[model samples]
Target: MYDVVIIGAGPHALSLLSRMLINTPDKYEERPDNKSLFFKNKSGVYKTKVKDNPQTRNTPRQLSTYLRKGGVIDENVLNNICVIDRHGGWMTQWSKQFDALGISHLRSTSSIHPDAFDLHTLVQFAEDHRREGELLEIDGGIRGSKFTGPFIVPSLGLFWDFCKSVVKRHKLEDFVTKGFVTRLLPKDGGYDVCLASGDVIVAKQVVVATGNIGVKRIPGWARDVYDGCVDGSLLHTWDIINNSDATGIHTSDVCKQMVKLNMRNPINNTGNTVVIVGGGLSSAHLVVKAAMSGADQIHLVCRSSIKVRQFDLELEWIGRSRFIKLADFYSMKSFEKRSHVVRSSRGGGSITPYVHQQLVKLQESGRLIIHEDTEVWECNKDENHWSIQLSNGHMVDCYIIWLATGSIVDVTMNPLFCDVIKELPINIIDDLPVLTDDLEWGCGSGLYVMGALGGLVLGPDALNLAGARGGASRIAHRLKC
Candidate 1:
């Protein structure tokens, strides 16, 4: 039994653990008369002091000490929180998949680091017992509950070392990690977590930090056309990423197919030749990367023309500059004219002129082409290739396809908590859990969610590095209460 059982050992879960331990009270101190000390800000957005209680007021100090001692949250918090079909180690999997497909560089700059949460702190805690590249796999789940004391703290590796230090310093070791939880229920009380190996855990409080595990795939219409094709003709980007075994295809193969299709079906190609769908930084990067990769013929297909506000100005300026030479720019307005719409949750944004100038150079060399204001009606498979039909009655024969589609929050697919999520009344935002303002789930007290799953209300930043930090702070405050 555990006091708090967190599903998924991703970044979000680790951050939450750090916050929770920081809030637990020390044992040597006398019981403070103030309950307000337990309640901090709703979210960890603001810092507050325990007006009448000095013990609780030292929460920040506790956190600082933990950090200095090299404490980190658990790793199991992000189970299966990865791109659907990529391979490699963790974050590097997607990059490797792109490389396997002959993609030289990513569209966006790499910003994630192995020790993103402060390596110095992590190193300090590891007295050389464990270093990078060490794999620690724990096989078990919470089974019941027990009350160790008022202080409930869980530990893992260096994080545990720091917790032990804090406990010894505060004389609070009676609160062991093995049996600190009080009660465990199926839904509201806690989550009934069952691992793939048949181990089970009943936790009093559950925090689901699983990112995009239960969400559905790209819309059915999109999947139908992409997956239905034979000869590797029409396919989603995910299929390409996931199907690492598929061979004899290169990124150039995809580009060449698009060009041939346009030349064969000039009417469709001329009006809406290439439709690149998506509106994220990934999309913008793809536009530039494609142009740089010698793809002269292409079109951007999207749902809306409204660019991400923050990136719009930069992209627009890039378009007006040399980058426009790479490919023709089109938006939802252009596609609407063709009576077709590509479904994507992300909105279109602008690109840099530097990238566009490269496109222009490619076009001058007869290597780049552009089609704006085009809509795809349907995609089907012919003998060995794909036959793509546009709304304008023009058909394109291509050997490859790329679906730069986006992702969603999905909990149903996670093996650890699939049953737990199904039994809860948790609200769903685009198929993600709806969290309270304090980051706790409304369905169960002490249960919370973070990361991309919180995107509906938290905005687009929910999956980025900044979002992780914000989530950590928020969860920390909740534990304080």
Candidate 2:
């Protein structure tokens, strides 16, 4: 039996793995006068190495080497850990989503990444690779917060390369098993992780790091119409990325619809119109893609006006104010109240200011239309096109209907945890489970959760890149303790 089994191999899993290694005591002894090579400036920011000691500059390189094959960590500790993913690869789903949606860069800052050893690891990697230009500054830096300086975001390509480097550096490939965990059966102070292929792995502890799977939220109309049918003309953004076949878009091939839409003739010379439903960043990306693909007109239908912001939430949650807010959040006894705060803080689907500006430019060019305060009242699909009626009394007949609607993170819907929950029932608020301060299930259960499902404790940024670091740190500390 393994000491620990991580359920998903996404960024969160990588973060947890890195953090666990950080917490694990090194096998090699260090100098007696060992001290931190890096130090913070008067402004309390941890920059590069101290200039006084030129030897200290190698500290970052030492830390980087720490994860290599012949690193300081004990081999037994690494051998005891097991990680599994459905795709059997690191960052498979995460990279797929980025490529499918054509996202240019990350929404979170550069410092917020999977590396748990140092916050500036990603920045340092960018500098090391001489791809500093890929680290674009966040439109507006955290102005009033102590987290000042250039709020940089890494390009998707750069981030992908960095993650690959992390996997290589950590030598994590040997620890990962390729399988889909179907069930988690807790017994005898441990759990049996059942995979889809009739294989089972027993572990003393389990970490459910699966990103938003089995939580696709569909609109009432779309559900009634499609009824789980894999229609080529209509597919959710998550569905397209996760299951490329659902929309006739093969993963290995460029989106077939783009070419088809560009070549298809317009109905009654009105041009090839496409309707995208939602106002989130994904929806905006789709709008821009369709517009660039020569779609005559694109309609963005939102139930409310588009909420534009630099990040998912205000800068406060990500800046130094998060500690105070988290303290207040933890103090509240009611899980329901905490849930309300999370929902309010997230608000709903929102687009970034940069993407919003792109949409506006497309609108001005008459290639895009924004329909705010409207919903898809009705939808009728034919062999040729889709006829949709908006709540605001506008009728749209388009060649394709893309749903950029966000997903729902319901822990109850997760099949792997169904048996575990039944065995040890825990308090759940609005589909989010109440975990211990260490993010573990109560009663000394070794099962732990990370990602959006852990929002009740991690706060609003629970699903973002930053949350990975926070969640991983908690779980790793608990395991080490």
- In candidate 1, residue 189 scores what lDDT? 53
Which stretches of model 1 miss by more than 4 angstroms?
2-6, 9-189, 214-222, 230-232, 246-276, 284-300, 303-365, 392-394, 409-422, 426-432, 477-481
Q: Report the Cα lDDT for residue 195, model 1.
A: 45
Q: Which portions of model 2 show Cα errors greater than 4 Å?
A: 24-71, 141-149, 245-255, 258-263, 266-270
Reference-based TM-score of each model: 0.52, 0.87
lDDT by residue for model 1 over 311-384, one digit each (tens)?
A: 22222211122112111111112322211111122234443333344445655765443333445667665544
State residue 2's C-alpha deviation in candidate 1, in Å. Answer: 4.4
